[model samples]
Target: MSDKKLLLLSSSREGQTDYLEHALPLIDGFLDKSIKNVLFIPYAGFAMGYDKYEDKVNQPFQTIGKKVTSIHRFDDPVKAVEEADAIAIGGGNTFHLLKELYDNELIDAIRKRVDQGMPYMGWSAGSNVAGLTICTTNDMPIVEPRSFNALALVNFQINPHYTDYQPPNHNGETRAERIFEYVRANPHRYVVGTREGTALQLKDNKLTLVGNKPGLVFRDGEKTRPIQCNTDISWLL
Candidate 1:
């Protein structure tokens, strides 16, 4: 497996907190001290314009003393990835994000750079594409991507913004139940149900779950497992 550095977050905010407030510390620590310039991928931002999305992320990075350049600003998007010391993807619609990645032919470029050890960070829909496929995303398939395949920076599939909550009188499948379907269909694969406020960190080839709440793990023919904070989950790698 390639040595990839990834911080996959469930959500940018925790509860009703400010945008990216809860994750700022994590973001600061994930980025390399030498990484002054970060390449921001704003493709997942469908409803909101790219400029607004970039500006939203810009605030937090400025607080961390880093400069963020959105890929959209670059005429040669692939070149931007090659030169970036770090990469960050904001959360939005998974399908739209994948479509843009494929449209711009950035999948290979990003995978190569991250495999070479450039630190990568993503939140919500952004984190969804870090997995093998976008099949487990919680987003509606408003747009069809060339394929469901994604970055594959990690071995397991991630269901970000995972929750056990079910509204009263709702007959739809629970989040866990939806993930179970993926587990059954892809028996060999493992799915991590990362709740809001939680993140899965991969550093030095070791994967760990961070945040207060435990993340649920789904494997074929196995009882669902709960991964606590600071727990090593490299087996999923």
Candidate 2:
């Protein structure tokens, strides 16, 4: 990827609880201070808590003097993503996010935009798209196929929401476990299991980790060996 071309802020959870704080700066970094146009798409919210999550999110950008316009639905979503000096897709369930992207032909459009040099930011499912495959996401196939094909923005795959926590009320396998099984079966790709507050930042062929703690990179069924940012992501790339 070109320098500063794609800033991925993949979080393990939803809402503004410090997640936005970690994500919003990437937007500000991309703000073309001279230009008044910046497009923000909020469709991932649709799959999560619905419009209930919108205002709280749209508000912070306003306070920062960032011009943010929002649209929901499969209707012309790509146009909004295509023209932004920067674009951010909020967090939500990957299944619904994929449906919206596929329905609107956004999968192809996003790949095109990034190629044309648009800096795109995605939290949660949005971040997963930057990888070559959606196989690493924590989301289940609640619907049909859902196109395992992805944006292919980076050669590596992302497993956001990569928590190793197991709450008493928690049901099913932990996100980390799911990814472990995935890697066990297919031993090629390097998967980053990002815990909450942790993000994989990619810019201009440079990839770095910022936030709460260091992330884990899994390969051949073993825990990661935490490579440094200056190393071209040798584990994954």
Candidate 3:
């Protein structure tokens, strides 16, 4: 059984809630008192500056009684990962975050630390990197990474901020259609369309959907299945 612990959130906010407000209780429960200093990665902030992003994330974490130290503040990020008790990656542009992760050479460092059983938490683009690759990301390719490869912490892909709503009078591919295209192209892969307010938590080789809403799982040659809350999805692990 895998020893890794992860909390992958679809978004920082649910509905009109304040930033990270909805996720505060979840984050508190995920890390617990064992995690004191959380290594924060804010590279996902493209439009917003990294310092601001760090502060934005720090607020909720402090409320939950956890201290946050962003990787950007450190002179050697790899070393920071080595000493971190836990890690939390904040949300933003997926393409930009992946590019920064590659540029900073954190991909392997993070993978190694998390593999060693350090708790890892992420939201939005943050959660996307926990998957096999960034190919299933919902963000536009504003910046290209060295590759679409990610932490590979999980075997499947995750489509964060998944929604079924389409604006009126718009002639665009629906979210499901786009994911179907990905499945058609990669027949061997699985993609989980995780909606807002929902998260996927992995602990002791068990994967549970956290939230009131159900998430959709897509696979090749099979109808998309709805994953209900508290369901064990270790089959995908």
**What is the lDDT of every predicted structure here?**
0.91, 0.67, 0.91
Candidate ordering by lDDT (highest first): 1, 3, 2
Q: Each candidate: RMSD to true structure? A: 1.0, 3.3, 0.9
Number of colliding residue pairs in each model = 0, 4, 0
TM match of model 2 to true structure? 0.81
**Mind giving the per-residue lDDT tens digits that candidate 2 earns over 153-191?**
878788877666888996888776777787888897778
Per-residue lDDT for 1-237 in model 3, tens only?
Answer: 558999999999999999989888888888868778899999888689988888888887888788898898999999999999999988889999999999999999999988988999999999999999998898889988999999999999999999999989999989999999999999999999899998999987789999889999999899999999998988888
List the candidates ranked by TM-score, beginning with the highest.
Answer: 3, 1, 2
Least accurate stretch of 10 residues (summed lDDT) in model 2? Answer: 227-236
Candidate 1, residue 222: how far the Cα is off, in Å = 0.7
Per-residue error at 123 for model 1, in Å? 0.2
Per-prediction TM-score to the true structure, in the order listed: 0.97, 0.81, 0.98
Where does model 2 exceed 4 Å of error? 1-4, 12-19, 30-36, 47-54, 73-75, 168-171, 221-223, 227-235
Candidate 1 TM-score, C-alpha based: 0.97
With candidate 1 superimposed using the best TM-score fit, by how many Å does residue 197's alpha carbon deviate from the native? 0.9
